[model samples]
Target: MFDRATTFGEALEDPAARSILERYMPGIAASPMATQFRGGRLGQLVALVPALEDLAERERFFAALAEVGDGAPRPPYDPAIAPDPAYEPDDVARGSAPATLPGPTPLWEPLELRFAGPSHGNPFVDVELEAVFTRDSGQVRVGGFYDGDGVYVVRALADTEGPWSFQTRSTARSLDGITGTVEVVAARDGAHGPVQVDGFHFRHADGTRHRPLGTTAYAWTHQPEALQQQTLATLADAPFAKLRMCVFPKSYLYNADEPDDFPFVGSLAEGFDLTRFDPAHFRRLEQRVAELGALGIEADIILFHAYDRWGFADLGPAVDERYLRHVVRRLAGFANVWWSMANEYDLLWSKDIDDWERLAAVVGEEDPFGHLNSIHNCRPVYDYAKPWITHVSIQRVDVYRTAENTDQWREQWGKPVVIDECAYEGDIDQGWGNITGEEMVRRFWEGAVRGGYVGHGETYYPPALGLEGEVLWWSKGGVLHGTSPDRIRFLEQLQSEAPEGVWDPLPSDWDMPWGGAEGQVKVGYFGFNRPRFRNLILDDGGWRIEVIDTWGMTVETLPGVQRGQVRVELPGRQFMALRLTRLED
Candidate 1:
């Protein structure tokens, strides 16, 4: 979705979306509220269309909404009611009076214990609190911090299921020496623990392969409520598995508007208190992170980025560590969180590699879960060789050959490769923000075959929405306009359909070919390369092949041959791929 906050009118920017909304609900697309819900992230505007109540019509509109933005729940097509002005973190529901510990604690889920202390001086600077839990498996100690409004909290994650005892210690009087006990229950369905690197691939702590089919909606959570809802709705339905976004609000290009909240307690005119935090803002982020987890999406949070007018981009090293510590204590407990140290880490003229190293150390020390971590780059890449960096979070070094370098990185870094930013599919004036959908989709295939991951982004400019220059999915969140997301979903489905082995970089005569089981099964994509056909010879013989048109979204299975060589005909077009598997005896 694109940012539609500052550049909205009565009607939705897209004619088709407006038409569908008008036809269904008659006047919703023209209402005063349409100024906001036209992909706004405020309260969700699910207009219940009485006319579209028929199952067929409803399905048609549902598909249309998904195509335009995100699919709605069974709809009357009415606008969703906005929540109260005061926002609280949306958390897991439990059945008790205190709402803190009314039930068995789920494994990998955050368990928070409240502590009250005398706030003598600067509570944020003075208080030091933590909870230690000892189990049959081992002993675990976690550091806690002071929450504003005279509150202090200690949080911990139970890694094992067994009898456990706990103790709390703090510099504050009442908070010190508190003790507790809790039982660790198995994780609920779809909740895999934190992500880890398993050799050349990524997996959950519980051993689930994590295919990071990612997208870069850099400030989706920073937009207004309606737009945020729209972004969530769009993601809830897309096949994307990971979302890369910034914790600090962006202030560049199409992302000039201020975010709804700031992570630190500060304002633009009057500077910020580096030691203190804006609780509501962090709570909102926590809520979004949880929602993403529910949708099977990893929250790849960029803790810092260079784009800023808000001084946040230039926090002193000590203050930066404080911000990192606060974020780790509050946000790292979630199962689907990934720590992206910074976006374009080199572009921040104020900081150096050593500064990033220091922040990474802070996150490393505080995040007990050891979630997947990396630093994205704009120029030279930060050393993934460093033990702290779990995987490679890369922005394209070269426009023409970005994702094709995946296997090379894997070989060089000996870790998982994520081409987090190859480019976007759009007609924008910027080179990075605009490319054909076909090229973007081709990068996805190229990355996948190389045993790595690809990232998605869209920057289609819709001037008709009066945005002439505002709102883009790459920065702000709004309706999806590019053609790459669906095709990438097809690629994901193909990856899931692999039978014998997982995809890997094949050392074949063709540089683009990727396969599983030492080339027993291969998938090759010819990106921007035109060849009518390729002549192939396999030692194993018995080969079944299929042609993949990444843009046309078609898969054509060809006849199998139990021979040494075969002539494969291609459309001689860009974004074309091939799938070959050895027939089993």
Candidate 2:
């Protein structure tokens, strides 16, 4: 029997309901398109699936569904968490503090000002709260967000070490006219602030090199507590410095489980309250961001994506604007956060180019720290030439060629090119999720040698391989069962030895992708091609050469220094590279 209010996901759980669905639309259960709507109402699926557009067919399916209905009670919504329309700001405390920011604030660390504001109407809609922090260097105006219960929080940071003063201005009378002073101090050791874009590369606010050796686990935060903890533990030891994760819970293949909490006040069954946020959810997410920061990993937070069972992917322009503003205000304070406007923006059919432009502008404007900003792609690439975009974030358009195009991308944009999603090292049914570990390591080296960075993902689903259920590392973020990560660590070690703390492509033959500071430190990679021996021209004397077996993780130093059209011996095997370090003169 079926519940009239049963969702596409709920129906799948009911044998009779699932059978009814299969009868009406054969193979709909296994359809990738249907899988995306597992959390959506049955009625909503008709609008998305073209086959149900017919009036007769739709009515017939509905009649059949009704015939099996037993009027099962739908899940009840908890009224305690719902916002009260009659609520108002408390009148207990009035007046501004001379120093709202705590004394002796660390540089580049955000300071907070909490205020009680009018809650008669939807503060999220009616209120506009911003604060200006001024110092001898300059001033920065940052937006604030409503954290429910009539509480508004404004956060700002001082880049320079000195005395800084701030004042608040808002639409509500209660929140306005607040003032503060902050005694900014030097940052502790190793606190390199937010990552900023340097021409064709990245460096921290303090000028420390940031090489983005990243990986993808898009919905890790939304997973269960135990799994999330395990993911964090795995990341602590992994070589990746950046994690590309999503703000919203995903609804796709191997990601159909319902999260305990959502960003909004309600659930898919009862309809979410778009105006109010779930504080617990945001708090948990913020905690995760801070945890990743502690582990020296940047959080590349993706705000939107097409994979949705809840209506988050299709939230109207107004809701979208409000949501973006709210998210930026809440997370911008963290130095580790990077604003990825969306992942696979083109695949989100509801948002057009104009919508994306407007949304991106909101993020760029709201973020006071101006962390790295970029949007990813599916098939069509966003124009990285746009002034707001700090760098290029790409998903490979061609199956056969991804990292190979890094040089062209770098030349075209003159910004750091990141091959964020070339492909995964997995054995899944989908082509995007199934590539060999050797191939994955090859892609990383390929991108690195061409002066671009690559990201890694795994999707191994071998039942006999000691995996816990169907938890795939690409989305669920459990134990990593891939061979590329260890190899990637070696690659990171090699790249870290660069004289400039990063590599730049040097002129070389078409067959070999070589990069580093010329006449100083250099690496030449042979991806799949194997040759018996290679000849190289060394400009200066005293160069030490080493043969690197990428897969075997071995580096053997050659006998002595070679110079001027030298013949370098090789193992004549695939996944090999050569490194040359000029001996100190």
Candidate 3:
């Protein structure tokens, strides 16, 4: 908006443009990005909106730019106006609603309203349906999804206790102008609805703490029946509260095989009908997800991924909407679902930032339960501060300092940080899949004590797990060979004992010293450092210190230390940590 230059050349050279670029992207704005704009493809500009420090100022800058012209952003949905139910559709049917949802729906559980719609000329693309559910709290406009067989469904979440009313609007006469009412009851114990971001921490809808000790098993569902069973069984006792898996099969470095089944009905060739979904594949996935929920694991369902031999990653916007809508209908109903937009969104070379946003809108429009949403990264982290993103799902770009930057990321994003993919633990060929188990455990402790959720993965050498030489754990998810899982489980136990289970990053003096709160508890992790003894100056006395051999899996409490100027001893080895807690009495 600052001095609109008639030509791209003038705009790139303008001092005003330079200032604007420095404020957002900086450094690159005047150089490569400016050159990129000069060459064309200006819509890539909206990706810079996340870099702005002020949330309100981004709107001011966008107000003047042309629609996708010179990189102007396509605005994300305003949570307020986007949910309003005032918009009317073409026809309103004044017919009897076919025996609504049986009885009272549980609070936070999805109350699905089904309708019969026209099956003419590709129902997935032609038909459009929406609903508005109103309670004393407010009204939310939810979009309807087609379930393959001329059936349209709308799922809505009840936030409060008591009766909630709703009205349906549709483009076709089959499912419009109908209204219904249902009672909302309390949520089942331990079923805390969906997970939400609560000020740098993740919590359940019922306000219960969710100390996320997560792990990744990418193509677990694509494995054999016996292997899949083994993975689920492993998860039952594994120290993971959250699991990251893909909706689509992964085809990458180690994994070269096709999945057991694809989500779509047709082949992976171009021009295939994405509108028609494979119900069998979805049914199988739903079973697995339900199993995960029963085992108390939050399912971080990755919708789109780039590593592919199939054409699933290259669908257009219209078909993408259909795919996402069905996904919301089928998966979002689960209380343990968290939507990861893509595994590495940037790698989807066909998709721009705007395309990803449109898909995010479909999630917001269809998922009434408001599940936690985030997009993971490969190189540069997707601007995690975006409005649509609920938390930071980070795949560490830096090999050595990924988990170490947990505090920095938490401070920057002001959201719960999940280091979703920091390298894996194994003796495999790939650099990413060959870190020692000790380093993996050390990474978890580093992120754990720094108030970030670190994710784990295993990729041991093949034939080592009593299986074929090619199907590795990182890709196949059969069994665990590394020792990091047990160590990570121990970290979870330590976090559970604290009332303030969610940790916050504090200023570090030693090898990254972190505190639970206002000096109630403190942890100092000497990652690769090995100091025998150190002197601590305490302002207040009653603090107890324990020597923690993180990899050795031992906790030894050191006694006979006085109030001020206490002496603390350590193992003087790698992956050693010290836990200091102030005694109540």
The best candidate by lDDT is 2
Ranking by lDDT: 2, 1, 3
Candidate 1 lDDT at 308 equals 78
Summarize candidate 2's per-residue lDDT along 1-585 as a digit string, tens digits.
343235788777777778878876665676877777686667545544456546587677777776664655544432222334234345423333222347687877766677766666777666777888898888888898877776778876557889878778765555666876778899977788889988888888999989999999999999999999999999999999999999999999889899998998899899998877887899899899989988989999999997998979877777788788889989898888888988987667566567889999999889867888999987767889999999999987778689988888999988999889999999988999889999999999989988989999999985848655779898989889999999999998898898877888988787888898887989999999998899988877788999999999999998967777889889999999999999976
Error of 1 at 312 (Å): 1.2
Q: In candidate 3, what residue range of length 10 has the lowest lDDT sum? A: 77-86
Model 1, span 1-585: residue lDDT tens: 211111123225556556766765565566766655443221112213345335476456546544554433332222322212212123412111121342577887877776544454566666666777788877777888766766666677657876667777555435556666778888888788877888877778888777888887888888889989999998887889999988888887877777656887878778777766888888899899989988999999999886778868656666777778888888766878899998887666456566778888999899876788899887767789999988999988887898778889999999989999998988879999888888888888878888888899988877944565577988776778878889988888888777522478887454456655564677877777878997877667577888888888899988756458778888888778888877865
lDDT of 3 by residue, 559-582 (tens): 755578877866577878777788
The runs of at least 3 residues in candidate 2 whose Cα sits more than 4 Å from the true structure, single-residue gaps closed, are: 1-100, 116-121, 462-464
Clashing pairs in 2: none
Q: Which of candidates 1 and 2 reaches a greater TM-score?
A: 2
The CA lDDT of each predicted structure is: 0.74, 0.83, 0.73
Worst 10 residues of 1 by lDDT: 1-10
Instruction: Please report the candidate that would top TM-score against the real structure.
Output: 2
Two-way lDDT contest, 2 vs 3, winner:
2
Looking at model 2, report the run of 10 residues with the lowest lDDT sum. 77-86
TM-score of each: 0.80, 0.84, 0.81
